[model samples]
Target: MRLYLTKAALLAAASLAAQPAFAQESDDLIVVTGAPAPIAIENLPAAAVVIDVDDARVRGDISLDQALADVPGLQVPRSGPIGQQTSIFSGGFESNHTLVLFDGVRIDDPSTPESVFDAGQDTLGDARSIEIVQGPLSALYGSGALGGVVNILPRRGGEGALNPRLEIAGGSFDTLTANAGADGTLDRFRYALNAEGYTSEGYDIVPERIATHDGEKDGADITTLTGVFDYALTDSLAVDLLLRQREARVDYDPGIFGNIAENPGSEIQSDTALWRLGASWALSDALSLRLSGGALETDRVSSDFGVAGDEYHGDRDFADFSATWSITPEWTLLLGAQNEDENIEAVSFGSPVTGEQEHWGAYIATQGVLGPLDVTAAIRQDDFDGFGEEFTWRAGAAYPIGEAARLYASYGTSYRAPSLFERFVPFYGNAALDPERAETWEIGGDARFALFGQTEGLELGALYRASEIEDLIGFAGFAYGNVDRAEIAYAEARIALRPTDWLTARASYANTDAVNAATGVALARRPEESWSATLAAERGAFSGQISWRQIGSRLDTTYDDFGFWAGTAEVESYDILRASAAWAVNDEVKLYIAADNVLDETYEPVNGFAGAPASLLVGIRVTP
Candidate 1:
């Protein structure tokens, strides 16, 4: 589609490459998840948000979910506290529809029944930023991206000098935590390493108000290790390596016989590791090529005192290659291919079951100035073992309004293939199920302006997006099947204020209207309305931040034990407030304290599961 194809529009877009999507907070804030390469926030016709996890230790954040609680339309739904079963609901899309990436590698689990990633279990260990790109992005990434992508970018070494850091904390609920990391650079190599561990007695997640509820507190013990190395073998070729591993033992309620959702002896122990090796080769002055290969291993076991336990093991091997041709200063072309193989096995009641899946994909894309608009177009073809072949395409354009404002729109198609566990799990599986396909379109704009006495910043951002999915997978009376179609419409309004350089404030309101086409009922666990706000300030050596969130009611279906339908359950709305304050004792040391659920409101986002309660933590850091 043409983007205001006029001579004036042409002049406007000629200098629109560097405008900020919301505000010019930093001229060097780079976002890499929106496209194949780093593109300006305003140049792409997609919606994206970047959340920084700087100094997480000083902020008393144990996991990445705490840093993401302020995101407008991204709802973190957890069955309990940290290390529990948790996922995110994005833009009213299904929980499993959101794909996650560590650096740039896919991390979706293949062993889980729904093939979903556990966002709650991932801790913020040496991460620099987290980027969220909204809408269907199947043209760039294949399955499990029907809603969007979440990429966690870690800090790298070799920038300049060597630095070392250590932190320790203890707080309410018998919690203890520690972190250590160092960054350094050598002759032609740079390296970074980080390790963190946490243990807590944990508060009880089963409320005493419910019948048959066990008052035993659920607890968690977790540890994470990260290593990154980069070597400049030559001027034209460079190699990099990444290794990450996490091990956890989490206690949870199993909702045993006659109990709403509690069991004293239920627990799970899991271990996961990821490793990747990548190299970039510049073949010529205008052409470059890149290649990477990686593998992920997962092992987990769950059980209760008197019940049968289950064990699961999964493995995934993946390889990717891409080429970039810089045709000119304003135009470029990208070609890429990806292949992945996954295998999983499970032991239930002393019976071992196994499954496998494979997929290959190739894509091409072009981007540059066209007529009066900056535009992009891409197409991809993916082949899966059971689903045969599927194709997806996307196109978008942006029109700038002089140097202060811009408008953009995009449309794309995406799909999700049936998981191996969904098709090979005993009598509950359905091998005949087909992949779910969907299309999405969005139009949004943001501007930069000055308020009070501040520099370039944003006053407002308006966005509206919609998606329609076909052949949604669901449970029938006998087995899983393609049950219904779903329609989703979302809109958000945001305002940011910078009264001065020392203080800032932001607030946003979002509405997600999603329903099933057949029954016209709202989707389960997708909140209809959400609100978020944050305020931060700095004075001398003291800094502080405050955040608040509100979520609306959600609807879900409850089922009986005999594989039969029961009734609908409504989850009520609630709000929470959190705050943090830090003080610099000197240039090499700092002290901080954080409080959660400051108002002490008691409510559950999910039925029968208790939310986190009021707690406080104090910590100290040493940097050299």
Candidate 2:
């Protein structure tokens, strides 16, 4: 890890030292995705990252986890991609700090044990694009947007006539997959459908100390289905609907030193469903209205091995309803509200008895724009059956300096309420734990400019973020406790240049500084610096990318100096390397290959789980 950091720093320094120094290109680029009008990046106070479908295709054999690898000041730990959890962090908060959304709808359960939802698995295989906004966003999105937001836009509407595709893949551990999709319009009704299924005999995720650790490795199988439909009425009004369902079965294997009798075998199966109905109506030549409403549901169960001795089950349901009115050419207003309900039940590890809890909440928000400036403000008030009421809020603004550059800033209050698990875990939950609160501020801008002799364009941007947190719920002295405060400061920058008509080069760097105010200690295992660089080029029918990434040292939460677990120590700081490529055989067919740990650097990012040695994968995509 030390060597990796040194090399990365040197490389960054070198890039900075040799720059010819050119101002970013400022232009009238449309920014319709985040706000009502087509604003430029420099005009919005919230720092954001956007990845389009074209960028996604040329970036190697996309490992869903790797797709998020380059986002500045962000962390997406990998347990071999596809099926693992990808936690998002901001201003030094945990995974739950960020909000993951699908078409502006939150996909998480604020009423559950772990308030944050894992969107990596659902969006990776069929996404059209992804946008990430860094900083507090309670004004635009309400609670759970404290760290930031990752919104996925799935692929829809294919050009020309009907288009269809199929894909299949197989790799180590008997991992297998099949994906199929189609897009077409019938009688003025355009629609798209995507479906995928995959299974894997996963590598062991347990620590190395247990005797039976090898076979105790866990595995997972998942299937997902999605569809989008749209219809136009009278050429001025349109209705749209979206539906999705995901199912997963995961087997458990406690690591190397775990005792089977005490830990036991475990399995979990989960089902998630979502639906939305909305319409876009033109009220006048200059006025318009967009309305939408949707609902989401999830069901999950965790059992001991295959036995039902003591089971853990949870369910979450939510509704999203919002209205947008284009008040004028330069200004618009949005009013929206959401309602959520959740429930959980669990039995003991060896007993069949059960215990349960229920929770619910609601929230609203509004945003508008004035010429080159835009503003957003929102608030959310939630009510937990036992916890009563809690509120979160935010406000922000953006100003365009030129057609190609903009300046933006924002301030907001966000929060993470105790998850059901955090508040009620049999042996872990603390009844006295308080809901975590955060006050955050952000500033940044994006600029576009000519590059490589002024023949092509380049995009450059940077963001600085800081936050102060209160009542952080954590564990201390074998019991749950609320740490009075925590502080975090972070920064991220990105550079993407189209040096030639057929080639693109890009790089990103990020740094995070965090401290536990109460203990006057810096959290371990939180990498201080991280970076990624890639060069992609294309010719004829072939395209490929060479990429590199490094993660700094992090502290282990399981660290213990006591004699009881002596010599069974943990290590900090590890680095990894991976590379991938692909080729287009025809307009509707393509083939790809990927190699993880290309240099085969051997080190563990997470304790116990031996990162995979160098591995290979080959797959084919067929579209007709």
**Reference-based lDDT, each prediction:** 0.76, 0.60
TM-scores of all predicted structures: 0.92, 0.83
Q: What's the TM for model 2?
A: 0.83
- Per-residue CA lDDT of candidate 1, range 409-514, in tens? 9899988888877888887788778889999999988777977878755567788999999999889887889988999999988888888887878898999999
Clashes of each: 0, 26
Q: Kindly report the root-mean-square deviation of model 2 from the true structure over all alpha carbons.
A: 7.9
- Model 2, 15: alpha-carbon shift in Å? 37
lDDT of 2 at 192: 83
Position 35, candidate 1: lDDT: 24
Residue-level lDDT of model 2, residues 182-283, one tens digit each, is 888876588889888878776665434434444444667888898988888767788888888888876654333442211336666767788877776666
TM-score of 1: 0.92
- Residue runs of model 1 more than 4 Å from their true location after superposition: 1-39, 55-57, 258-261, 306-308, 348-351, 557-566
**Model 1, clash count?**
0
- Error in Å for residue 302 of model 1: 0.2
RMSD of 1: 5.4
